[model samples]
Target: MKLIGSSTSPYVRKVRIVMAEKKLDYRFDEESPWTQDSKVSESNPLGKVPCLVMEGGEAVFDSRVIVEYLDTLSPVGKLIPSTGRERVEVKTWESLADGVIDAGVLARLEATWPDRKESERSQAWIDRQTGKIRLGLAAMSRGLGDKPYCSGIHMSLSDIAVGCALAWLAFRFPEIDWRTDYPNLARLHDKLMQRASFAETQPR
Candidate 1:
């Protein structure tokens, strides 16, 4: 099997964390879809990454699908509940985390228009996305409350998704100062960082 993605992508980090938690080893092919001649299109028709190519030549992708598939590979550290409302809760957490990252990614792209003057940089668009990130963080902190993990006592896909997103923000948009704004999130991010899966895959 082979895992494909850029090192800094939060979505790719989610899939990598799951594989690491499951103790599954596979070849890593670093390919950002944005680059010319990138092989991501071959594995994923959508031309995005975190694509997992199995030995049989089939590719599983985007981050959510890949993590769900990896979770079933071993029962050792199941990140998602198999049934009941618990499953829905975990999935909801994932959606929130992923959505926040999506907003951040959008803001990042829009803010990078080098040719655009500062006054023409669409501050409104950037503010909208950043506002979403902050609101999402607030929701995550509330959901985590006094719990040790994102969804109850056990670490799940919820934890992985939120952790990756927060870490990516720290990497790309350090000026945003999210950690200080949400103390609970800061604590959870610190706790998740202690895990080998998260430690080894820290964004470059």
Candidate 2:
């Protein structure tokens, strides 16, 4: 398998962390979708990063799909529950984390699109996305409370997703001090950072 993505993408980092945790081996093909010469579109129609090309030449795009499929390949460390409400809860946490990341990405694009004129950039759009990020963080903090992991005692995909989102925020938007506003989340992020999977895959 070959994992194609840039080191800076939080979604790509999430997939990488999962593969590391599962003890899976794959080639990392570093490519940025934003670049003019990028081949990301060949693997993913949407031209997104983290496109996984299997040995047989089959392509799996989307970070969520790739991680779930990778989890089924090996039982080294199951991140998502196989069935029942537990699965739903873990997936829900993942959704919240991804939502925050989605908002942040949109906001960043609005602020930094090179071709757009200052007059063309809408601060309202950026503000709206940032609003989503703030709300999503609050909800995540409430859901986490004092749990060692996002879902429970064991580390799930939820923790990985949340950690990636928080890390990305810190990387791209240092002005948003999530660590101070949510100490419990800060504690969780700190703990997650200690793991080799998280430490080695920190967003560039």
Going through the candidates in the order shown, the clash numbers are: 0, 0
CA RMSD of each candidate after superposition: 1.7, 0.6
Worst lDDT run of 10 residues, candidate 2, spans 113-122
Clashing pairs in 2: none
In the predicted model 1, the residue pairs found to clash are: none
Please write out the lDDT profile of model 2 over residues 49-130, one tens digit for every residue.
8999999999999999999999999989999999999999999999999999999999999999898898899999999999
Task: For residues 1-204, write the lDDT of model 1, one tens digit per residue.
Answer: 999999889999999898899899899898998877898999899999889999999999888888888889888888899999999999999999999999998898889856677777788999999999989988998888989988888888999999998999999989978789888889999999999999999998
Per-model TM against the reference: 0.94, 0.99
Whole-model lDDT, model 2? 0.96
Q: Pick the TM-score winner.
A: 2
Worst 10 residues of 1 by lDDT: 113-122
Candidate 1 error regions (>4 Å): 113-121
